[model samples]
Target chain A: MTGMVAAFTATILAAGSTTLLLAVASLVVATILGMGAAFAKLSGNRLLRTIASAYTFVVRGIPDLVVMLLIYYSLPALLNQWIDAMGIDARVEFPPIVAGIATLGLIFGAYMTETFKTALQNIPKGQIEAAIAYGLTRRRMFVCIILPQLIRLALPGFTNNWLVLAKATALVSLIGLQDVMFRAKGAAEATGMPFTFYLIAAGFYLFVTVFSLILLALLARRFEIGLRELAP
Target chain B: MNWDVIAENLPLYAEGAKLTLLLAVVSLALSFVLAVPLAFLRNGRVPAVRYAVLGYTLVFRGTPLLVQLFLVYFGLAQFELIRASVFWPWLSSPMVCVLLTFVLNTTAYSTEIFAGGLRHIPVGEIEAARAYGMSRRAQAFRILIPGMLTRSLPLYGNEMIMMLHATALASTVTLLETTGVARRITLNYYIQFEPYVTAAAIYLTLTFVLVSGFQLIQRRWAGYLESRIG
Candidate 1:
């Protein structure tokens, strides 16, 4: 029992931080891609709309596990071959973090696109029109008129996507990323207490998820300040 | 771009597609059966049991299904008690392990979906059923179950497609479902995108069919539910 406890502690020490790092990095990357996709979907150009829609449809249909494996194992070989043909003797290999982040970012990007698009549509059109008629620059209009409401409206769906994405970082282990899940597996093998170690990993994940929900709720409250009942 | 490569491996892909369907359909059926009773038990007057089931659903929802699968497949075997039990032999099989994980995971998600549908059941309907001199069992059989299933069909359909996506995780447990076969074909052929892309195409077609089927259900039933609730 003591051995299992010590092994779990060591496993958490070794890989827990990496797991958090992966989730945060991928979440940022995914949010950017999602914003881009959302804009492309809403843009006037037919080709952009078609491309964005197709990207989302493709991503949503396939599982993230397949996408992650493809990016990790196959993409490097494909890239390296091209690099070799360019008179470079060097090979290209993505570190597990890079591959995990990029694959997860791509997968979650589809979900966030829908969240963003729905949020954008819910903004009262009179508000955007008023901002435009007041002669604000595009940047100014976005910052001053649109951004605040967007954040408020997007928070609920964003919270859901963020929770799901954070849990997904666990899958990075399958691609040889030494995240908490990976370390826990090693601990299970070494200590012969697979349940003990796996339980520890699940605890860490549940903690991250619960913590995120609390933080998101606070953020939603902050963004929802004016519209809520402050009956004082 | 390599149509020839996919054409050569069509049989392998077809085999994979079959397993994927089997895994998803069987598990989903079991989840539906498990979820209906759990949905009722979820709100049963016993706070202790209710909280226990809620905890079960919460754990499943709060963590990744991959971890849950690993916990069952690899973690449980470490226990001497499990190894000595009759259940050990059942859990020893990979396909059984995968099916159990999917069934448990889908049951949790579907329980929430069905519970939501149950919440939408108007009180007056239950009273009407009671006033009509119907027994509790008859009321449940004649009205509540049908009403809940009908109302939750759209959400349940989404859950079913999610289950389809989840069959990809079976590959991690060594089941050669669609995504698993794709990985093999990719590594063997030294082509990354071709096999995975083909798998994605198959998955997309399945999802399209699922969505259309649900849309038909929604059109038939949404008007009925909206009038009852709205």
Candidate 2:
């Protein structure tokens, strides 16, 4: 019993950090995919737009749990088949963290694309015209006219996606990842103090959520001043 | 690729889908019933009642639904007092436990949405109601409830769709909903991946349908205010 208690206390903090790490990693991946997909959706090519929309459609439509399960359980066989065909001796299965981040990143990437695509399109037409008339390069125009307002406009949706993504990091526990949730479940099972451990896990999630809100608000405020200077 | 296995289990998947839909509907209906009054109470002039609802919403909204599910499903059984209490029979069943959790969780979220809508009711309108000597019940039903529900319909629709997605989590608690049967099918036929695909397809289809359903409902009830409502 004492040993179980010690293990529970030790894991609570360690797993908390891992969950944060997972959320951060997933956010980074989502950002990259979001930007790429957003550009694709904005492009003149019909095929590019179709593919981009399809990606977002399927991802946004499906539940996160189903995706997580599919990625974890279904991908290994395909990887093995490829490895065997290539004459490699090694076998491949995603580490639980790898699968968790990949699926979350993909799922949230679709949401980000929606945010980015709409924000990009909604930038005032006059701003771009002014930048072009000033003989600015495309890159310069984007930097001067598009990026600032885009960030300001996209901040609310971005913050929402991040909060949701953070909450979703809990599902990693279902796939056998030793995030705080998994550890809490184990402790609750062993110590027979489920209410305490699970409540603590909930507290951990709430703490991260509240802290992220503060950080994101400060970020939004930072960009908001630039927006005010531009438009106010 | 195992068409045989997937084909054989189509009925089972359908059953699982039915379970998922049933669970979501029951949870959503109960939560709505509980939330309307709670929303009214929270928006009332009483600070104490408002704060109590505030705390309830904060805790439920702050944490993940998955955590709440585990806590309610597993946590309640840990207490001898609860086990000895008359409510133990309901709490002991995973189905009821999950329903209880969903009702509480959705109540918190829906209350906020409803209250926000209520808050948007112009103060002038309330004063006008009072000036006309309208009773509180008359004012509530005729003015407040009608407008609030109309304005909040779109947002509440989104919440309902989210709750529908959350039914997927029922599998985590060992409930044999769509996702649960998906898990079982995957285990039973480790060589085949079609079951997972089928499950995803089912969820995606349901989401589109629900999204369209919400659109139709909004178009019907709040259609006249479409220029302002959505």
Candidate 3:
């Protein structure tokens, strides 16, 4: 018990921090990439539309676990070769943390791209025309009229993607990151009580996800205030 | 890029792919079979069943699949009762435990999807059926189930693909599926890119095939429903 307790703080810090860091970085990156992809998807250019469509279709079809594995194991080797060709003696090392974040961001960005694209198309065309008629510049129209509405409309799907992405950080342990699952595995093996340690780990995950869900709900409610007339 | 190494291991990789496909298809079938009844029970007037499904879905959806697989395989082995029971034979096999966990987990998720589909069915249709002298069982089987299945197909297809990717986790429990084989090969050769890429290609191909099959199923089911209505 003392041994488990001794490891508990370190385990929590490593797992919690890594997981939270990955989620925050991925969310930011995913949103930006998603917006780009959304624009590409909605663009008049056939090549841009096809590029975005292909990305969403392929990423959505493939399992995220495969993406994580490929990025973690294969990416560094490919990078190292590139570095060697560039006359750098140092190995182009990709740490597990960076790999996890980048791969997850890439995978989930494909999902969010679709969500944001839907939200973008959902906006009334008349509103954009009205903004244009008012002599609003493209940037001003996007800032004042489009982006806010897109964020509000995309919030629910974005929240869902966030929760899934958080849960997916567990897979990083497979590539040798000492996250919660890694520590839990160690404690379980040492104590010979797999159930107890795993249950604790699972509880922590549930807590994080449930807490995030509550925060998302609050955000949704706050957004709803301006549109309360539609509320019953 | 080592053609010789890949050629030497080609048969082994093929076997791994076979195991992955088997695990996915079997688990998907079992989950779908189990989910329909569970969905029915949850919607029925039974508090015990409803709460049971609620708790089941919460635990399954909330926890990571890796932990769930670990708990079922390793955690249960710690129990003398589980070891001593007649069910021990089935639980002893890693594949069985993986299949069991996958089925139970997917069933919980799909039941929610199924219930949502059920809720979307027009109450007027059921009422009209009753007025036309349709029995409850007949109404449910003929009208409710088919209607729910139609609406639920697309979401269920997504779940199926998710399950395909999920089978990769079975390697954790000593199952030598595709990812499992890739891990072992990577450990041996210390050259990661080739093996991981191979596994990823296999998974990507499977995903493509599964999506296309789902599209066909959707079209076929839609036509069947249309013919019935006509």
* The best candidate in terms of DockQ: 2
Residue range A97-141, candidate 1, lDDT tens digits: 999999999999999999999999999999999998999999999
- Please identify which of the two predictions, 1 or 2, would achieve the higher TM-score against the true structure: 2
- As for candidate 1, its clashing pairs are none
Point out the worst 10-residue segment of candidate 3 chain A by lDDT: A5-14
In angstroms, give how far residue B24 of model 3 lies from its true place: 1.2
**What ranking of all candidate models by lDDT puts the best one first?**
2, 1, 3
What local lDDT does model 3 show for residue B206?
88
TM-score of chain B in each prediction: 0.94, 0.94, 0.92
Taking the candidates one at a time, how many backbone clashes does each contain? 0, 0, 0
- In terms of docking quality, model 2 is medium
Reference contacts preserved by each model: 0.71, 0.75, 0.69
**lDDT, candidate 3, B50-117, per-residue tens:** 99887888778887888888888888877888899999999889999999888887887898888878
lDDT of 2 at A83: 85
Per-residue lDDT of A1-232 in model 2, one digit per residue for the tens? Answer: 7676667867886888899999999999999999899999999999999999999989988889989887987777667767888999998788999999999999999999999998998888888888988999999887877888889988998998898898899999998999999999998988899988899899988888789889989998899886577694
| Per-residue lDDT of candidate 3, residues A1-232 (tens digit) | 7676557645654677766777789888888889899999989999999999888877776667778877876888778877888999987667888888888888889989988999999988998999999999999999999988888899988998898888888888887777787778877787787777777788878888889889999999887776686767
Best by lDDT: 2
Per-residue lDDT, model 1, residue A19, is 91
Which of 2 and 3 is ahead in lDDT?
2
